[model samples]
Target: MDLGCNRSGKPKLTATIRRADSIKKGCPFMLKGRFDRVGNFWKLQVVNETHNHEPFVFKEGHAYLRRMFDEEVDMVARLHMGGLKTQRIVSLLCKWFPGACVIDKDIYNLIEKLKKEIIVGDTPMQVHVFEFDLL
Candidate 1:
């Protein structure tokens, strides 16, 4: 509902609100949201995951998402361990697993789900924003 703008031309994002529509009611996937503050100091909560189960790690004839000769999970773990930025992670992935198409969004989504934390870093810089240290 017109979430307004954040000084810049970019529209400020808000929590996903489903309008009263038959399509939303008929949809099987459940919606969830989380709030995160970016380096630009703007806060927004977006709908992250819908389905209860994980998407297919592999499809009928080929790798579905990452399609890497090496598994993505391992690479993700390595990136986390190395504390690399999204671009660095992608570069490392390219070096190790060439021909793999690893999107930063996908990497963020995977990191969010598996690590239960937000990938907080700037575009040209890197930093460990936060970690969900649950005791």
Candidate 2:
């Protein structure tokens, strides 16, 4: 979760970055125990009577929530280099990275990351190539 803020709270943006996360911090998860009668669910207990932090409001920006594992990233690179479209890649990623909240935007971000690793700095050249290919 390089949220544009370094540990010292400074920006180190190398490229144009757009962030849409509204994640917060200092939230604790707690709940009260309610009886479940469907399947004799007596194995649950509540240790705290009150939840101190807001879960819903601060649960968005955790890096683990949307992070791609090393293996997952490798698969993404393989799938992309094999000429698979982004949409298809995303669909397959869901199957491969089950329980992961991966979206098309994440796929595109990963693709761009892979591109950055290969091509040093040719963003403008990419745009020019796109235009040339369209002709």
Candidate 3:
């Protein structure tokens, strides 16, 4: 289990109820919970009660995985490629989305993932590549 921060700057916590030792077992049982400031307590909710797919052993870079739309990712990628720092990008995003709040690390992770995708040929960059890539 790992404790983290959510997009809204609230505490985001997750726990693995059951671990899958084999691919035949499918996905591991996991639960995502959050802290409610108003109630001053933690709420444990089962986001995925069952696993239909195999779980990765090495979960590195998985922290950046969230429920974001493709358009949002594209917009963040564009901003990241535009030479905006992670902090500035986060501020802009928060402003554009009043109810939305983002942390620096998440933005950094998103930008890093975008850069890796571009390098690995998984995704194409819309911005021009200068001598020093603004990553």
Q: What are the lDDT figures for the candidates, one per model?
A: 0.51, 0.62, 0.60
Model 3: which ten-residue window has the lowest total lDDT? 3-12
Cα-based TM-score, every candidate: 0.37, 0.49, 0.43
Model 3: pairs clashing at backbone N, Cα or C within 3 Å: none
Local accuracy of candidate 3 as per-residue lDDT tens digits, 1-135: 333222213232445687533223324455677889999998887755654544455433344343346766787888877878878887887787664446787777777777666666432433345315674
Between prediction 1 and prediction 3, the one with superior TM-score is: 3
In candidate 3, stretches whose alpha carbon ends up further than 4 angstroms from where it belongs are 1-67, 121-131
Per-residue lDDT of 101 in model 1: 70
* Candidate 1 positional error at 42, Å: 56
Q: Count the backbone clashes (under 3 Å) in each candidate.
A: 0, 0, 0
The positional error of residue 19 in candidate 2, measured at the CA in angstroms, is 9.7
- By TM-score rank, best first, the candidates go 2, 3, 1
lDDT of 1 by residue, 21-48 (tens): 2211222342333344464444444333
Off by over 4 Å in 1: 1-70, 117-135
Q: How good is model 1 by TM-score? A: 0.37
Q: Which candidate has the top score in lDDT?
A: 2
